[model samples]
Target chain A: MRIGDLAARTGVSVRSLRYYEEQGLLDSSRSPGGHRHYDEEGVDRVAYLQRLYAAGLSSQTILSLLPCLESPSAATSDSAFDRLVEERDKLVTHIAGLTRTLESLDELITLNRKRRAASVADPDSGEPGRTTQG
Target chain B: MRIGDLAARTGVSVRSLRYYEEQGLLDSSRSPGGHRHYDEEGVDRVAYLQRLYAAGLSSQTILSLLPCLESPSAATSDSAFDRLVEERDKLVTHIAGLTRTLESLDELITLNRKRRAASVADPDSGEPGRTTQG
Candidate 1:
């Protein structure tokens, strides 16, 4: 398909598609007229890349892993699969850490808002020089 | 304090501190000896910036929000606080979405691993030619 059609089908901007290609996350062959052409499998590839990215994997990591999915030799090798499992486990742990930190940030934001509201309501009660003094 | 002390105290690398300064997330004044000097409050500021970055906020967003914490006018203004609250809410939503996606990817990886393991164990049973197949 052409770039415009691929962008519309994937719901990704053409610029991002180009960027992904530049990052080696996507590929397109040139036609006889020098225009880009992508096969139907490109859609699935793009979707997989998007999923990896959303999971906080870097473009470089995704590019490296793409070969494991594409090459039958690597896909069928027990050791390769084992390595993939280990990498995925690390990714899960990393995501868990990020999730915990995100929750803490949410709590901090909530507390900050509450403190600000209280300070606004009671100018002289909480923390001298912090109410009308700051 | 100098950059090295600040890095030692914060547990951040000196290179990252310099990068943060280049990204406008940190500031340092020069001493008479041509060395960078930071006030005590710089520690808290760096910590805050780290927290924001860990929360998945971009350096640019953190830099923009830094002024709110530093300037009494913006910090105390109800409108500015409201904007901050809104931005924080958006950030929370974004983090939640990413967390959900991460969880889904974890499940997908688990399923893939299980399928691969079963295929490896039974070379002739599952899915014609898929056992010993690619």
Candidate 2:
């Protein structure tokens, strides 16, 4: 399939497909007309790349772990295995930070809700917002 | 204090601090020599910015939501309030995706561990990794 076809199937932009190719995170072959072509497995490969990218793995790190990611076993090189463990630990830390940020957002949301409720009760918004038991 | 002081205090790089200023997420004043300076509140503001960035907010989104981030109240502009809610939803989605990736990594780790254990038991590893007993 053409690059555009892969992009459409995966919902990833063609530009990003090109970037993944540039970063060596993806592969393609040139057609007779010099257009990029991908095999049927390209769909699954693109999705896998997206998952790793979403996991916050840098291209270099992803490249190192590619062998393990594509095929998991005890036969994976010691360095690749170590990289997998390290990346996993980093994900844990990032998730914790994001969770804290979510908590802060929730607090802000709650504060806003309470203030709105107070304003409604007091009619301090100045437009007679109160409804008489409607 | 200078940019370096804020960086040292927060452990964020000076370049990142400058980027935050350019993004309007951090405030600074210039002295007669045109050196950027931050006041005591700079420390807290940098930390706050770090939290927001960790939550995966883009600079533009952070800029729009700054008024509320600096001080949350019922009086925040309607647009900023809406942005705050929108950002919260995005964070939820991102956290969910990261959680899935973490699970995938855990599965890969378990697969490798199982492979290693099986290799040891079968002795096909050919190295006699197992001990007879102490």
Instruction: Compare the candidates by DockQ and give the number of the best one.
Output: 2
Clashes of 1: 0
User: Total clashing residue pairs per candidate?
Assistant: 0, 0
Here the TM-score of candidate 2's chain B is: 0.82
Q: Candidate 1: which stretches are off by over 4 Å?
A: A18-24, A27-44, A67-75, A78-83, A119-134, B19-45, B67-75, B78-80, B124-134
Deviation in Å, model 2, residue B92 alpha carbon: 0.1
For candidate 2, the share of real interface contacts preserved is 0.36
lDDT for predicted candidate 2 compared with the true structure: 0.78
Judge candidate 1 at residue B16 and give its lDDT: 86
Candidate 1 scores an iRMS of 7.3
How high is the lDDT of residue A126 in model 2? 31
Model 1's CAPRI class is: acceptable
